[model samples]
Target: MSICKWIAAGTLAVVLSSGTALAQGNLDKLSSFQTTGVTEFTYVEQGGAKAEAIRKTLAGINLPDGFSIDLYAIVPDARHMAVGPQGIVTFVGTRKTEVWSVTDRDKDRAADEVKNFAPSLAKAIPNGPCFSKDGFLYIAEQNRVLVFPAAEFFYESPDVAAFNVIPQGELVPPEEESYNHTARVCKLGPDGKLYISLGQPFNVAPAEKLDKYKKWGIGGIIRVNTDGSDREVYTYGVRNSVGHDFDPETGDLWFTDNQVDGMGDDIPPGELNHQTAMGQHFGHPWFGGGDTRTNEYAGEDVPVEVVMPAVATEAHAADLGMHFYTGKMFPAKYKNAIFSAQHGSWNRTDPIGARVMVTFIDAEGNATMEPFADGWIDENGEYLGRPVDVTQLRDGSILVSDDLAGAIYRISYSAQ
Candidate 1:
């Protein structure tokens, strides 16, 4: 059968099995040139006993001098966020089935509303949200890609038009799906293509699975047109890169790769990689984390040239979402620097991470990673909040999403 027929049949099977009527015909309305509804805003109350408790916790967060952190909104399982063109609304996604719409409708710089975005749609792990300059909102799901037209305008109601960019089961084979590394992230590259990361489901993929993973682009980043055609692998030899972004200056791709585990805590280091050209392989199973080879691939000959990381972070740091600071709210030294979230370590004897990191890129394309905002891990090794993704709002403040706290925090700089 043709690919089109196969896709159609697979889509039907998925719809029938999932008991969801998200058919192509229904979503196709997203492509139409119609604006059908009046935009409405919902205001969320920010004061309560629970709010006071959260605010008290925020006091423990430490940042640079002249910086303060404030509670932005109470969003459950907030993962990644995409701010709209005019900064009127911020669309957030999660590792679960819901995408949230957050708005500061009164322009108070504090969110006045936070609610599910298009709650009518049956979404699965809609963890990645990217927006085009022209009001097109693309969400990368675990097994699908969806585009919402004029998401900011029609987000208040459930009638917002959404079209599938990559149909279900096309991102990765359904059989290979696993709970590990299934939280996909996406970004609209400067070249106008949508880039999605597909993390291979393994701590260190075995040699037997290397070829299959490469063939499926399972351990790499894939790119395609805005319409979801011409799909191709952009990079490979990565274990599980949950976060990546294009450099604003050179348009090069830089990503954070979670290193391999069970290597005595400190043997293999987490990676911050710079991809200057396409198809460049970063050492993965062969070199396990940074340069330490895994037992599974020991003594095996590496076929391709491995690209060394720009910076090697501590092992098990679990670096996730990242963004380059381009907002004017911060000092000049912070402009164009990278801010990433270290989701904290789980397997290490002494937990390390659960904070935000800053990487300054030099003129020669080198990176130096350092702790930016910490205090998430207390002296007793307890977690206050685990930072997931870092993004900048229109007014130059930085927003950090914490899944553990189920809230988003805004970091603003004010000189004393």
Candidate 2:
């Protein structure tokens, strides 16, 4: 990479990740609209054969001492979730075309109502749903972004107020549209900006496509104002980062990236990256995963300084959605730790990573990971449920979404 090309890319990343760059969303632009005369919203039944099957699957899950798991809701293709700040609703996104709103109307710690959120709007791969501390909700789709004001209250109705943050065909170039590696995940940064991760649509991004990918914020994470202004690519050199979160203590961003495939099952490992600065690049085509260099872009003059992962998880683990555990329900040892889901391997001879993982960060910001929950794979080597994402409830207990089982399971702790 030439100095000029690197500088040109880093310039925008620097400007965005810099502390001085702050969000300027037009809050006044958010207005409530009713989808009157439209009432064909499909609702998921809380009790039935499907729910019983999910409950039976949860019975075989393994967790640590003092922890328990229960079937929270029956959701189809549930990917990532955003528990409403008001404690009235939880918005769940899916790999399909629907985002479901789940509500525990009785405060029973289990969802009572599960229905499509914005059934009137056609969503394309709306897989990530996140909320701001002040009640704004953001959903990251494959090729667009949308927001809802007072989503907690409006989610009860089939038609909630919806507005485009990054309109269709604007989040990424329409010509580069793809279905693979396009499930975007999003979160609100401390600076009140919306940070969305764009997965480059390839096993290893091509050399010719890297420049264009960086320009369009593909294969990297980008931040924009709440109203979708002042867009900038914050992190670069990432390959299909499906999950990330900010450290509540230091405000630093951490993410998990799916590594290169077909390099044998155990050579190039999966990554849990820590980004502490602007324009920081996590090795992608250069280093497949960790220090293992890629076979595609071999012998190339590597230019930018690549940020290695804090922890190189097992290869082919397929680590997906993650969140820092900030709840009070668990023991003090778990505070500030990270809870992430490994969706398990797709093509490995022996499957791995179909469970929830907890990583403890030491005082020096170093991280170590271990299996917090597992046993989702059956005795016959079949996946009972593949965990996708983790989020905390108001009660401090955490909820995990499983797309394989099409359900959300709640993990709460109580002294035995």
Candidate 3:
């Protein structure tokens, strides 16, 4: 079709789809364009208005004083990341089912080399990672854990033949209607066990079903030995916890629980929970976030002692990547802060979160959630990047992985 005719059709389509003639003017203004060099492209307005400078793919990031952030490396489908000894940053990509190992050999704190750490079938959506002292790597797929023996040699693991893959045993008991599910894994716990999160599939099932499933155990954290033994439920009432970590300071286990959706836009915000005791319920189908009841499964009374979240994030924030800031690169106030990446939300009509946030904690372990870094969610509901995970480097710098933009960012601090 001729350029003029193509422009005319585009204008008419826009007008019809918008149910008004308001879009026709903009369409006509963008009707004419030009091409320069073979690799160069440009769009020219018919009214002779100069083209504006294209916005940077990444902008609007806000960090504390003396802190700066930059794109570390370009990674396709990079989702969650784990930092290893000697500045090794490994990311698990769910879409491509590929794990990437990044390192900064030049010591600039940016990943200079990206190597394919592992590859799996399309069904394998790589979730999270934990490392053993023997250099073995533990990664979570959809519903299982795969052990990579001596994963330190990932770039040289010839033909994938040198790596060992092991699947974890199921935690749900036999005859149980519910099954094991989730995308989370924790380092071998203090008990030398690997703690895994089992997410409730449905937001809230019928009371009868809940009663039946509770008898067999469902919706909670499950733990087993590193070799996958002594399987049992650690806690219940968690809807879907995507992030978990063991505190380096207190040796306590901390996790982030995602709230159930389909609730009102601002009712039940997500949760930042700590495992106070075994068999503790953090209020799933009954009392929701902020101790507010959903009234869905009424009369199914939750225990009064059920623990509340240590802190509350934005509603439908899709929180993930709970790592405590024990590194020394930041100010004194951030020494014990818990950092989490809010992956943003799609269930809400407007976006809620898509940035890295920090929760400052005192020596007594009291915490307050506050915005540490933002600018991933825009006023117009556009997300520039979705930060999935944050990892600490040896030098105290931190790396954030954006699954949407397929990029890793390094955040560093220096006093002026």
Candidate 4:
């Protein structure tokens, strides 16, 4: 055999056996290439007929008056997004193995390039990406948490510094891991701690599993220091929360909880909850979703006080990623409003969501939600795009990610 063939076989053997550890070793080969400046990189552009088709789809989307939606980039399976400081790059996560880096080098609003961020490390459903103000990028996976120091500067080459914040199987026990509700979303709280959502692995957690679930915070949000210290449950009794954000003004946490299924299609509504303090429980097993009681725990006595949702959305809208609008480009009325994505529903006789919704907060902290952008779901119940997460850009525009269509869209406002 040729020398090159022998080397390739050896490399494959190591990768198949050692996995990520071997992959990390291979990244050393690219260490000599320094990633110093943003201008040095040239990103691949999204154009041609595919871009035109995406544009056509965007034209059908309906936004409020004076607002327009444009194709920001064509990202595959773009589950969640975390824009880097100054919005130099947008890091996107997915339910699959790869995380993407979408860059707009010349500040054109449209992405100049969309490419895999860190191709060296073997990832398991890296669905959540969050960046600190100081330039640290963190990704929350199914059963692990990884931190990439200075990810914005060093993402060009594969030699980016990577460390585990929470090692594999430590986020949740290996025995308790399930295929369901493992799409974890994370964010850096105003308190500077890393908050992660651990969705319980069941529709209605069985009675026997309640104790373990509470202990591990399997159905709740967990917070810890950036270094993974002082881990504790911030809230409990949540069925499955795929999206959450800290209110920029109040520093309070708000999240979207996917309510229990199997209740009649329209009986139990999804929730947008407010957590004022720690240890608060949002009714789950005791009350399946909203005020509807679960069949399993219907007659059981409530163990703790339940905090009702701030806003009760249409049942099975599959509400996900939310953000408080702090951009100046929009009208003053939209300032501090909550913008969220509804990924749409399955198993319902009628389809719902698949668009963006806005929530207005009154002086007394009361929230009222209304549709801000629609038309993703057609009259025949077909989904043109399933919106997953909503994020903001430095240019004061909003970016919405769609996992089904594998695309990210930019929503901007203009008086004209």
For each candidate, what TM-score against the reference? 0.90, 0.92, 0.79, 0.91
In candidate 4, what are the lDDT values of residues 1-416, reduced to their tens digit?
11111111111111112223424343234333433222221123476655677788788898889999999987778899999985678999999887889988888898877767766566788999999999999999999998888899878764566777898889999998888999999999999999999999889988898898898899999999999999999999999999999888999999999998888889689999999999999998888778888888888889899999999989999999999999999999999999999999997899999989999999999999999998988778898899999999987899999987778999999999
Q: What is candidate 3's lDDT per residue for 283-311, written digit by digit as tens?
A: 87786665777668656666546788888
Q: Give the TM-score ranking, best first.
A: 2, 4, 1, 3
Which runs of model 4 end up more than 4 angstroms from their true locations?
A: 1-45
**Candidate 1, 8-74: lDDT as tens digits:** 1111111112222434344544446343232232223454554676788899988899999999987
By TM-score, the better pick of 2 and 3 is 2
**Clashing pairs in model 3, backbone N/Cα/C closer than 3 A:** none
* Local distance difference test, each candidate: 0.84, 0.86, 0.64, 0.85
lDDT of 2 by residue, 339-360 (tens): 9999999999899999999999
Show model 1 residue runs off by greater than 4 Å. 1-46
The model with the greatest TM-score is: 2
RMSD of each: 7.6, 11.4, 13.0, 5.8
RMSD of 4: 5.8
Which residue ranges in model 3 land beyond 4 Å of their true spot? 1-55, 93-96, 120-123, 158-181, 206-218
Query: Which regions of candidate 2 deviate over 4 angstroms?
Result: 1-36
- The predicted structure with the larger lDDT, 1 or 4, is 4
Question: Model 3, residue 149: what's the lDDT?
Answer: 60
| Consecutive 10-residue window with the lowest summed lDDT within model 1 | 7-16
